[model samples]
Target: MSFQDEFNSGVLEVISPSPAYYPDTSRLRITLGDPPERVRWRSKQNLDFAYLMMYSQPKAVFYDQLDDILAKPHFITTMKIAAYDRIANKQSRFVLDFCQLGFIGKMFRCVELPWLVQLFFMFYSDKPVDRLLENEIHTKVSLLATDDAACRRAKDELWVHYKPSLFQHIGTQPSLKEKLKKSGNAEHPSDRFYNTTVEVLLKIVPLSEASENMTSDGYVIIGKFDSRCIAEGVVSQKLGAFSELRLTVHSVSDNRAILSEIFIWGQEAR
Candidate 1:
């Protein structure tokens, strides 16, 4: 069978039947539980933003917060589409936001993201990057647990990283400008990024000469994984800011695909 045939047949796992709300609503009075307390910030990044946001809130209230989001359609489907944006348009933030809301690899799982979506999210973020990258283009921080320059740069980038596409405001976003303009970063936060770094989960598959072997569907044997396994990855550079440059890794057999996702952060990063 063709790679496409195999891909459509199994490897990919769906998020189950679907994520939909009942179209019909009936009034039913019920006793309520204890009131929810305010959630305090655990860290500067609040990596557990989803969990903390939902943990303290009552179940009804927790889901209610996502009413605007859930009311539209099954988030799984929406995120799946968003995953494509990340791949097709290099919209890394969209994919990351999906993971943020869906909690891709978190322990205190809140929502479920389809397996393929998770892969695409990571693949795009894990663009191959040069360790010696400077400061101009999108740069990646090493996931090391030491106070070092590279790690510091990485953490700072993660802290300052922002994407305007995620917002729908009407005017200039002064708040974002302010966030981007801040200084005073630690000389070194740590050293050595993690294997689980969200944008660093790349699997490199080298091909001999794919043009000759590849099928019309653009499918190629990729280390037993599909080409659409994840989003395109960070690029190799001397030193740069975050980028939206999409790297096409499925052209020739010799060409390799670089994929990444937010599989690691917070405690896992340590």
Candidate 2:
């Protein structure tokens, strides 16, 4: 069978079921989390701003926080016609907002994601990225553990070593007029690009508070396009931010035949 045929047959897992509220649609409520030590700062050359980079260890992986999952990777996609509901039903909204408080992952239990939507994640990122997920990108998902303290330590060291310049102490620098003008125009192209991507994602997704829970907290965002494609576009649009960008579809159950979950991750440099 063709890849498409395989996808339609039993290859892809569905995370939601059809219903009138979503009418001819399916959804999976996605939840995300980070470890307390996974958050850190990075610098972009042009903007004179520090971009926050969230990290993870091999055993200490980030999760979508969905409940009763079979613990395996699932294949999925976001066709052009896919759309997400703006008004999550009252019941669904409650599920999305409350998934984190339950210590679902910390205590090794699953919590209900909105159940009206699907979830996805990033399983791996090669140091030197060659390409990114776009239309029809394929991937699998899996579970990770936090038992390897050594892996976590290695990740911490690597993060500190290659983190982008934070323009540390910029607040102490004088904001001279001419200097400001030169500095504004002198901003790095890469930094500008990076800022743009974050801004776009913020506008499109339900981003967490800028100053809130740097680690141990995350956001669930709904956009009109296939998440995998959007993620790939962002990665390609800001290719220099990292050496690689990839994703996995953990659970998908949309009836619209157009949508899928797209999870993102920040990786260590090779």
Candidate 3:
């Protein structure tokens, strides 16, 4: 099976290549071994559209709006009650079916948004889950994203679209002002379009040291010489010595020197 990779902080995580992978929920979880000795954080944008779509991704929280209001009983017990009986009739699917169960299990595996979408349950739920007291809780939920919800922020009011589970998870509507007070570091897929990658710095140092370091990191340096004639002589002397290595030039006072090093291979995990 194919795999996908994500760079988070100093570590790299690889997961299932499923297209459904998102920051909140994923199908598989695996780390790409241990942290590399050194890593350069490259600003790459592969999922900018998805990241841009989110207004304020709320932290996964435990919020039960119907804590004392609705009794926590069996999955269908609340459905049979007077408050949910009407909802049951409208929704014939009593218990979760196999497909629903699979997706629900996936959600459970992620452990973020549960079965309830208290306010905007429609976004996350195919059919209302009265069993979770979310059907009626819709009336109490103030957070909303209309059918024609726009991605743009609303003036004088913060706006969110598509993710109603945020309201149910946060227990209350989020304050955009509060969210903006903090900074965001996650890279979006569209970020590459506007990303300005400039030459941060330039260093003129000894080539042997730099080449040695690269070699230690699994880079195959074929030759390190001061001039083309000397590089040819060194290679001619050891015909097949650096055949498997990638040829490189490191000149110093007309002298040739070659250093070998080890390095880890591959980026991220699959």
Candidate 4:
């Protein structure tokens, strides 16, 4: 399997012995482990455009439109429902299917929007989730990102926009509840699949500290760090020494912040 190794906030640089291994992409491919064991993966793109193109011209248009919406720092309701469905379903045979798309989208995002996008679902069946759904989904994604407390304004909005359905599902899955309690939690494929998304914002998004005093107010406050180097070092070491990492960040009244929590997302006792 291929995987991207992030170190020191910048892209992990490895010298490939052969040019064949180094494709046109900026990423470097490396083989790790004794006896020549290795993993091949790329983080440049997360969707599959080729497969998407096979659908129809309308599908392609929706795909482009959805990309526009997702490129926004926040959700765009004008996004086609079908586009959301493909992503929610992991619509690719493998990664790198959307390599070019991710490359283009990153440029658009930097120039235009900054907040993550949200798609509204119809409550029950026919009723569309209110605008509050955006807030609620944001809070939930924030919680999964492991951010808590720390934002007074967002905190207030969270309570005003709380949803009962969240609690009902929480009981059915207590472990997920526990996972939400920590920060910098290395999200699983499932976590990445569901909930709102947190794309690595800006040049790089570091793994922040985990939250300690988490609340049911629908948010997790993982701490934030200054440099990507520090973030990658912490995250890399944690994964190497442990197995998984749970990342959390706490924000003080000021825009500045500190690391409050750090949990190994997929940690297993040694």
lDDT of each: 0.27, 0.21, 0.24, 0.27
Q: Residue-wise lDDT of candidate 4 within 204-267, one digit each (tens)?
A: 2223532332334423323333332133222233212322233343322222222332223322
- Give a tens-digit lDDT track for model 3, residues 1-270: 423333544233333334443333222122233122111110001122113212112432211112111122352332224224434556322122111110121111112233332222233222213222323223223345343233111211221111111111111232222211111112221211111111111123234433433344444333332312222112222222222334443322332222221122222311
Q: Against the true structure, whose lDDT is highest?
A: 1
Q: Write the per-residue lDDT of candidate 2 for residues 1-270, one digit (tens) a residue.
A: 547776688654433322332211112222123221111100011011101001112222112223332222211111101112312322111111111111111111022211111211121111101011110011111122244565444333221111121111222233332221111111121111111112122223222332231122222222222322232333322223332322223344332121122234334311
Model 3 regions lying over 4 Å from their true place: 1-116, 119-151, 159-188, 193-206, 211-270
In the range 101-170, model 1's lDDT, one tens digit per residue, is 2222112112322222233223212221111112211233443525566665555433222222232212
Quantify how close model 1 is to the true structure by its C-alpha RMSD in Å.
Answer: 22.5
- The residue ranges of model 1 lying beyond 4 angstroms of the native Cα positions read 1-36, 39-82, 85-95, 98-149, 152-162, 165-270
Q: lDDT of candidate 2?
A: 0.21
- Measured on C-alpha atoms, candidate 4 has an lDDT of 0.27
- Clashing residue pairs in all predictions, respectively, total 39, 15, 10, 53
